[model samples]
Target: MVTIAIIGRPNVGKSTLFNRLVGKRLALVDDRPGVTRDRRSGEASLMDLEFEIIDTAGLEITGAETLEGRMRAQTEIAIAAADCVLFMVDVKVGLTPQDLDFAELCRRTAAKVILVANKAEARGAESGVLDAYSLGLGEPIGISAEHGMGMAELRDALVEALGEEAFADPLAEDEPEWWEEEAPELVAEGDEGEEAEAPPYDDTKPLRIAIVGRPNAGKSTLINRFLGEDRMLTGPEAGITRDSISVEWDWRGRKIRMFDTAGLRRKARIQEKLEKLSVADALRAIKYAEIVVIVFDVTIPFERQDMSIVDLIVREGRAPVIAFNKWDLIEDRQPVLAELREKTERLLPQARGVKAVTVSGETGEGIDRLMKAIVETHEVWNRRISTAKLNQWLSRTIGHHPPPAVAGRRVNIKYMTQVKSRPPTFMISTSRPEALGTSYTRYLINGLRESFGLFGVPIRLGLRKTDNPFAPKRKRPS
Candidate 1:
C-alpha cells in the first residue's frame, strides 16, 4: 500500500486534510496548535484510489526528552516509512522559515513530495501559493481542505506520484447493490421449500463495529490494542475523546472499520456541553454500527449504567458482544471469568450467552478470542431460518407447550416466516396478535434461540394479523 505522510509546521490544516481523505472526522481537529500529539494512520481514498494516510504532529525544535520532540520523532518515523509525503503549507498565512526547514527535511528523506498549499479558497491565496516555489518542492497543488476545493487536481497529483499502483474505484461503475430475496411462503409442514435468505454479506466491505462503554472502561485502550498502535489518546482522563473516530483496518483478511466512541455517562451526570456532544456522537456511532462491543473494566464488573447501555444497543437492534478489559489486572483468572460469565447471563438476558471475552487492552491479552467472538456473533445476528424449518419448529412448539388460553379461547397462530435478518426479524400471522403475551413471545424467542443455534443476538418477532381475504369475497358473491 502507498503510504502518504502529511507533514508541516503547526496549524497548517494537516489534520483537516487528513479527515478529508479518510472521508470522516476521525482525527481530533481544533484551531489550537499541538492538539494532535501522536501520529495517526488511516485507510484513505482519493476519489477511486485508496492508500494509507498518516497524520503526524506538527514539526518543532525541542529537546528529544520533551513531548513535542517525541511527537516529531513519531512524524520522522512516518516520513521514513512513507512511499510519498504530502508537505502541507498554510497558504492563508504564507510560507514561513519553518516551512523551508521542513521542506529541506523532506528532501533529505528521499521520498517523493507533493506540496499542498492549503486554505487557498480566497483570491489572496494565489500570492501565497506562488511563494511556495521558493522551497523548491515543485508545483504546489493549491487547495482549501476546509472548503474542499481542488480535490480533482489533488487526485491527479496523487495518482501521478503513486503511479498505477494508486488505483481508485472507477467513477463509471456503480456501487454493487445489496441482494434481496422474496419473503418465503408458509408451505405445508415437512414440505421441501427454499428459505427466504438475506443477500450474502459482502465481507470485502468493511464491517462497521463500535466499541462503547462507561467512562474510562478502556474502550479506547482496547481499540489501540486491536490496531497495535496508540492511535487514540489514552490516559487517566475519563472523556478525552469527544468525537467518534473510525479507523479502517483488515483483520484476518476481513476488512473491518472500528469506531472508538466517547465513554457514555448517565444522562443526569452530563452537565457540560462537551460531554453531552460526546455522548450524542457515541449514540450516533451505535446506530451506524452493525455490531457493538460493550466493554467492561473487569475490576469494576457490571454496573447499572453498563446494563442501560446494553439495553440501548438492543433497542437499536444492533448485535452486541460483552467484553471485559484489563483482565491482566485480575487475580485468580478462572474464578473471575466464571463469575463474570454467570453475571453476564443473569444481568443482560437480552443477549443470553453473548460471547463475553476477557482481554487486557493495555497488555494485549485474549484479543484473538475477542475478535473471534465478534465475528461469530455478527454471523449469528445475520442468520436466517428456512420457511419449512420455521413452520415445522413452530408447529412442534405450539403442540408441546402452546400459547396459554386467552379468555377461555386459544389464540390461533396461522403462519410464521422470517422477514429479515441482521437482528433476525420474523413475522408471525396470528388470530389475536394482541393476545400473544410477552411471556409467550419470550418463550418462542428462547425456543428459536436454542433450536436454531441463535444464542446471543436479539431476535425480533413482529406480529401481523392476517384475516381470510377470500371470506369477504365469498360473502359478496352470495
Candidate 2:
C-alpha cells in the first residue's frame, strides 16, 4: 500500500482524521496539545482507495535532547518514509509561523504533498482556506475531518496528486501475512483444479493488548522482558511511565501490538494534570485493547487497587490475563502461587477461571505460558457458535432448570441464537423476556460459558421477544 503521512502542528485533527479513515479509534484524540507523543500508523481505506496512514506528533522547535525534540525527529522519519504527505492546517485557527515552518520542511522533502484544511465546516474558515495559498503547496483542499465533509473531493485530490500510486494492488496491499504463518490445504471438487485456500478467520490486524495495573506493579519491567531489552525506562520509582507507549512485534508468527501504559493510580491521589492525562490515556488503551494483561508484582499480589484495575478490565469486557510478575523472588513457589490463583478466582468470580501465569519480569520466567494464555483467551473471546448448536445447548440447559414464572405465568423461551462475538453476545427469544431476573440471566451466562469452553471471556446475553409476523392484525385493533 502507498504510505501517507498526516503531518501538521498540534491539535489540527490529524488523529481524528486518522480514525475517520481507518474506521476505528486506533489513535487517541483529546483537546490538549501534544497528547500524541509517538508516531501511530494504521492500514486505512478511504472510499475504495487504500493506503497506510501515519499520524505523527505535532511539529515544534525545541532542543534536540528534549522530549519535544525527540517527537519532532519521529515525525520527520514519517515524512521521509511516506510516499505522500498530508499537510493539515486548522482552518479555524488559521495559519501560523509553525505552519509556515512545517510547510517549508514538507517542500524540502520533495514528496507528493496534499494540503488539507481541517475543521473547515466552521464559520469564517473561508479566509483560512484562502490563506493556505500562501503556504506555496499548490491548491488547498477545504475539508472537515471532524464533520466528514469533502471526502469525495479529497479522494479525487489524492488520485490527482499520487496518480498511478493512488491505486494499489489489493492482493499485495490488503492480503495479510497469514500464509507465511500457516498454509492451509486447498479443496476442489473437480480433478486437478488447485488454488491456495485462505484462512477462514482474520488474523491480519495485530492483536492489541494493553498492560495495565497499579503504580509500581512491574508493568514496564514486564514489557522490557518481552522485548528482551531495556526498551522502556524502568526504575524503582512509581509512575515512571507518563504516557501510553505502544510497540508492535511478531510473536510466534502472530502479530501483536503491546501497549505499555502509565500506572493507574487512585482518583483521589491523582493531583497533577499530567497524571490525569496519563490515566485518561491508559483508559483509552483499555477501551481499544483486545486483551488486557493485568501485570501484578508477586510481592504484593492483590491490593485493593489491583482488584479495582482487574474489575475495570472485566467490566470493560476485554479478555484479561493476570501476569504475576517477579515470581523468582518468591520462596515457597507452589503454595504462594496456589494462593494467588485462589484469590483471583475468589475476588473476580465474574471472570470465572481467569488465567494467572507466574512470571519474573526481571528473569523472564513463564513468559511463554503467559503469551499462550493471552492467545487462548483471545480465541475464546472471538468464538462464534452456530444457531443450531446454540439452541440445542440452551434447550438442554433450560430443561435442567426451567425459567421461574412471574405473576403466575410461565416465561416461554422460544429459541436462542448468537448475534455476534468478540465479547460473544447472544439473543434469547422468549415469551416474557422482561419477566426474567438478573439471577436467571447469570445462570444462562454461566451455562453458556461452561458449555462452549468460553471459560474466561465475557458473555452478553440478551432477551428478545419472538414476534408473530402473520398472526393477528388484531394486535392494533380498536
Candidate 3:
C-alpha cells in the first residue's frame, strides 16, 4: 500500500483531518500550536484505496542550530519517506510566510502534493484559497477539515494521484473468472469430500492478548517478567507509556501476541490532546484483542476507574482475566487476596466466575499460574454449545425460576440459541423483550456461565421478540 504523509505548519487542522480520514482519534488534535510533536502513522482507506498515512509534526525552522532544528529534521525525514504529501494550510489565517516556506520545501522534495485549504467554513477564505496557487503546487482543494467538508474531492484527487487501478472496488464484481471454470477432478467426485472434513479451525494461531491497566500499576514490569527481558520502558513515573506497543513471542510453545497499552486515566487528567489520543488508541487495541488481562496494582486494586475499564471490556464482549500485580509488596497476602476477590465480585457482578490471579512482576512469582488462567479463560471464550444441549440447559434454568409477569401478562422465554462465541452471545426468542428486567437477564447469563463452563468470559443474552403467526388475525368488525 502507498504511504501518504500530511505535512504543514502547526495549527492547520492536519491532525483533525488525519483523525477524520482514519475514522478514529489516532492522532491528537488541539487548538494549541505544535501539539503534535511526533510522526504518528495509521492505516486509512479512502473509498476503494487503502494506504498507510503518517501525520507529522508541523514544520518550523527557528534558531538554525538548536532543538527546533532537530524537530525540523524529523519533519524532513517524514516528507522524504512519503509517497504523497498533503500540504495543509489554514485558510482563515491566509497564506503566511511560514506556509510559503513549507510549500517551497514540498516543491523542492518533488513529492506528489495535494494542497488542502483547511477551515474553509469561515467566510472570506476565497482569497487565501486563491493565494495557495502562487505556491506553484497544483490547485488547492478547499476543505473544512473540522466540519468534514470536501472529502469526495480529496478522495478523487488521492485516487487520481495514486493511480486509479489501485482504488478499484473489490466488492463491485462477484466471483473471479477462475471460479467460473470447470474444477479439475481430484481423485473423482465420490471421494466423500475427504471424509466430510470438520469445519476448519486453527489451533496454532497465536493468541492475541492485551495487558491493560492504569499507569504505574506494574504493567510494564509484568511484561518484562513474561518476556524475560526489559522490553518495555518501565520507571516510577506515571504515564510513561505514550503509545500502544506490541511484542510477539512464545510461552510453552504457544505463540502469543501481547499488546501493552498506555495507562487509561480519567478524562480530566488527560488535558493534553496527545494523551487523549493515546488513550483512544489503547481502547482500540482492547477492542481488537481476543483476551484481555486487566493488571491492577495490589495496593489500589478494584478502584472505581479500574472497574469502569473492566466494564468497558465486558461490554465490548471480550473475555477478561484480572491480574493483581505487585503481590510481593502486599504485607498480608492471603487476607488481601480474599478481600480483593470479594471486591471484584461485588463491583463487577457482570463478569461472574471471572478468573483472578495474583502475581509479582518483580520476582516473576505465579507467572506460570497466570498463564494457565489465561489459557483456561481463552478456552471458555471460544466455547460453543450444541443446540440440543443449550435447549436442555435452558429448560432446567427456566424451570428453577420462571420470568416474572409484566403488565399482568406472563412473559414466556420460548427458546434460546447460541448465536456466536468468542464471548458467547445467545438469543432468547421471547414474547415481550422489553418487559424482561435486568435481573432476569443476569439470571440467564449466570446460568449460561455455570452450565456451559463459560468461566471468565463475557456472556451476552439478547431478548428477541418472535411474532406469533399461529394466532388468528382479529377481523375488523364491519
Question: Which one is best on lDDT?
Answer: 1
1 or 3, which is superior by TM-score?
1
The CA lDDT at 7 in model 3 is 87
Model 1 per-residue lDDT tens digits across residues 1-478: 6788999999999989999999987676777777666577887887777888999889997887666676688789889999999999988999888898889999999479999999999778889999999999999999988889999999899878878755644453454522212243333433325544445645454577999999889998898899998667676766656667777778978778888888888898999665676688789889888889999988998898899999999999899988899888887889887898789989999878678888989999999999888888888887778777899999999999989888999999978888767788888889899999999999999999999998878888989887777675544664
Give the poorly placed runs of model 2, Cα more than 4 Å off: 1-205, 468-478
**TM-score: which candidate is best?**
1
Model 1 stretches astray by more than 4 angstroms: 18-74, 94-101, 122-141, 150-208, 227-237, 240-257, 268-285, 404-409, 470-478
- What TM-scores do the predictions have? 0.78, 0.63, 0.61
lDDT (0-100) at residue 426 of candidate 1? 83
Summed backbone clashes in each candidate are 4, 0, 0
lDDT against true structure, model 2: 0.83
The deviation in Å at residue 65 for candidate 2 is: 15
Name the TM-score of candidate 2: 0.63
Least accurate 10 contiguous residues by lDDT in model 1: 177-186
- Clash pairs, candidate 3, are none
- Whole-model lDDT per candidate: 0.84, 0.83, 0.79
lDDT, candidate 3, 274-324, per-residue tens: 787778878988987888999988888778779888988999988899899
lDDT of 2 by residue, 15-82 (tens): 89988998977676778888776677777988979888988888998886776776788788889899
